[model samples]
Target: MEDVGLNQGQVFLSQNVLITPKKGDTYKSSRLSALDLQRGLIMCLMAFSHCRDYVSSVPNKNLSWNSPLIEQNISSLDFLQKSLISLVAAGGFYMMMGIGIFLLWQSRIKDGVNPKTIRNYLVCRGFVLVTVQFTVLALFETIAEGQFYLYVGVLFSLGICMMMAAWVMYGVELLKTKSWFGFSKIEYWLPLSLGLIIILFSHGVIWSNHHYNISPDVLQIALLLGGEYHTPMFFIDINFTPFPWFPSVALGLIIGKIVTTKKEKAWAPLCALAFIFLTIWFVIRTANIQGLFFFGDYKTISPNSAPLTWQSYMSISKFPPSLTYFLWSWSINLLGIVWWFKLEQIQPKLFTSFKALKIFGQNALFFFIGHWFIYYGLSIALPYHLTTLTGIITVWLIGLIILLPLCKRWYQFKSQKNKNSLWRMF
Candidate 1:
């Protein structure tokens, strides 16, 4: 699992010192606890969105971020819930995924593990994720639809990005070994370059899809890249497309590399990045321009339908993730990382309260897949019981109560397994 991205023995900064725990040792660092707290909180809050989708009386399609804010049927509460859920989940998860990759690379490389072996393991783990997406995760959709509904959701896109990250790491290693001039900061430069280029490219593709009459062949390809798709083959939905979302992972890698190496010095620059991203989001939204790395201007919303306010304007496009969405999401995400780190040190008791829920974060992959089943199962068994937003949230709370102990057990089981164990794939 260390080679594939879940590295429990990762390096973290504690009290301005860099600490990499020994193999089979524990992390006493607040930074690690903060990360687990953040992840656990994300996983726990994410279930509310899922419960709303499966059990709420409102039609699921009407609950999407793209739906008109002025729609007569959608309650303001539901709209706010869905929008907030969409805002928080993926940006943090993908950033953590990138961080895991770098930490694994750093740990294994320090132990003198072969780079090729690490790359191969990453590729294998990625394919396993893809397989799980198509099989286990797809089972519910296929059975419900009565056809082969291939849904390319988060795990599928993550697997593709993981494979791509593997190759990128391999190339960095190759350059380090074979190049004439020594390249010291290749890791930082590479992912940063790739992330920016992909962001620009994805924005362009999405723009083109909106304005152009694309052929079916190109449209299918666009589906894999970052554009919305329409096809008659069964029923399909891609929650995340590989290319556009990969930037989050890339950005995480850059941050992880810096924090693990530069230690405390990383804090200033990270805070600055969060500020810059926030500024860009505000400027772009206010400017109301829709070209060259921006899309879905705030003013584009139908003015006659409803009174435009700050809240309405802030609810930007999420699916296929417009540049504004990425900027806004990651700005908050970056701030959270730094905020958590500081909070843990200044207020240990409060941090401990949150860290107690780290069971959900520690076993995030398991919790992610298991939660879908739990909520969906609840929907079937208790059909029509969850008619209100309160009931939906009640179900979400109950699901977390059930998942917490289960996640703890799973974490314990996973802990005993060797690095090569297949259980680590979760």
Candidate 2:
């Protein structure tokens, strides 16, 4: 939520001009409509993923749980759907966050906001996100699951990544002020450099724990660094870790900078870059080259389970996402951006026709919070599990239907000039 989209009272830019609207007012910026639509699409996919988790009877294990990947017990279609969602959903969200933050920063600069003031504001927002994750979200999950565990989830990770990005921005500013670096455009290289470093070193850092027998304190630190955590009483799994996700945010920042700075021509080069990355990803995955991390051969309990093929190659590690995972996921996101850009150009009305999805995109934080409660209530009242794809889609559509009005109402409330309550934090 920290980087989901515009804040409650923030005045965003439409093209290069600053539009100062009333507090909580929505700006009809067509340029950013594509982003909202993309976010909406991501939310739908996320709902489907959650539907599978709550409704499906199949036991879904982590793709990277064993030395070799385990062949999924699910049907081929289910496996494919889950695989794509697992790879792209979370990474896409983080990338969007990065893009959102950059846009926010650019808008603030256009409004003559001081750099320090902007940084402080972002820092506060980041802290609020982290707090909400541990408190509001944690409470919801505890109530739903009937268990009390400190779930450091996506919001927490996003908050931490925001703070990191803020520092990185500050560092870039400092470098620009100095003549020693001899580079005026350090911002262009910083995000990619930092992202590549994190991706390349993640596996080695995790491996060192096994060889050297890291202490509990050190292990806890490693867990924060995206290392696997498994304990009888407490587990800090990679899915919930923040470190591995930082790279996604970083990469997103790079794209965001390009979009905000380059304008219309950005998409062509970005699309080409994404295709190039996708090509490289295919080559590396097919050859089983360890550019960032090595994946083991897939093992299956049943002989009839899904075979190890290109699809299997596509099912890379996600918890601590490998380089290949980042490339594939971000490539899809970039291509989606290109596709949406073209669609928006050809038929803006057609692209914006899905009012419900655009609403969901605008009020993502509210929907995300509310949907969990909806799922929890449904799971309790229905007390039925659905195994087939049709059943899963049904449940997901039901969720969307249930959420649409709530999201719409909340969006209306949030858009009101007088409603400046803390509830707007969502």
Candidate 3:
């Protein structure tokens, strides 16, 4: 990670010659306040989205994120609002996770840690995430909904994907020592190339589900691939399946490499990539051919008009995030990264003044679990009639305010622990 206070005159002496890079060549660190602010905002948005569960006017028991937005008959504003939220919430989280993994791996290597120890720590951390998702977080959901089923959500997907990616990277590390073969090239491109393959194959998975009569017993794999499947014993619901969601993390790793490894500033190249992706997203969505997995037969919103225009055709699915969703979400997220990087450089005090976002980002894992407890507990304690949007907004704000002090305390406590402490897992 580049230090925020990095000196522009810092130079390396090569063969007794001091080489100083230009002022504009310096890049901000990935571990700086900018990244924290982004993470903080994502957590806040996630909490806002969850607040809808108990605070909204209408019941969302059957709301499927897998379904395309066009099918909902929402206005353009509604679609845009949901898209922006989804882009940052789930997608942003996974991408940040990837960046976190890369940074952790790099830090460990720099500190001369044993490879075995580093890999073991990551695997253990992954298990901790999996356990919390299934046990603690599941309990929270059960309490809120008054029902009990295994909670397979973004956290679970994150845990599984993290472990899988860790092992893959470990294997790549092992290959580096073999001079007889050209395995070094696999380190950087493997994750990204595999991610693309998995993403493309996901559309085929959707097609397969429609054309083929897959058996119910085997269909339980939907927890990995996505879509609904049932068994005689239990009902399984998946929000972010592992394979489909892996690309976000994989892309994060690629972006992390760019920001951290480059000798020059990352904003320009990142901005260019963002624009490129934005263009591709627009073209594909306008075509309405590929990049769309759940496009159902078009239907008229009213008796008098042709099937709803471009809005219906362009809207994308989320549950397993279609290619179009992937493109647009990441494009916007990339721009966000560049913006935050610039913000850190131009207005450091303004960036630091958002203390709530800082606390939330510093203790992200704690805030993630703690916020749910605050909101859901409050919902149960309060009157059931408080379902209006205004009511929810008030509740959400109060919940956040309540959480701020608690998150600060948690951050303080976590900071005192050793790097290897179990508390560090949070």
Q: Write the per-residue lDDT of candidate 3 for residues 104-216, one digit (tens) a residue.
A: 77667777877778778777877888888999988877776556655687778888778876776677667766785364556568778888787767666655554584542
> Which candidate's TM-score is highest?
1
Best candidate per lDDT, number? Answer: 1
> Is 2 or 3 the stronger prediction by TM-score?
2
lDDT of 2: 0.68
lDDT of 1 by residue, 126-241 (tens): 88887888889899678656677778888877888888888888888888886662757888998989988887776665456545845435553545443334466676666676
RMSD of 3: 7.1
1 or 3: which has the higher lDDT? 1
Question: Per-residue CA lDDT of candidate 2, range 1-426, in tens?
Answer: 523446434444233344576653332244356676677778888877776777766445454523344444546766666566777777888888888877777777677777787677667667878898888988876666555656667877877888888778767766877887665557678888898787766666545554486643654354444444555554443345677778888987888788766777778888988999889878767665333434321221233444455455665666666777788888987887777777877886887577677778777788787777776666666657875678778778888999998877776665653322455556
Off by over 4 Å in 2: 2-28, 58-61, 65-67, 70-72, 180-183, 207-238, 289-307, 417-424
After best superposition, candidate 2 residue 61: deviation in angstroms?
4.5
Report the Cα lDDT for residue 342, model 2: 78
Candidate 1: the clashing residue pairs are none
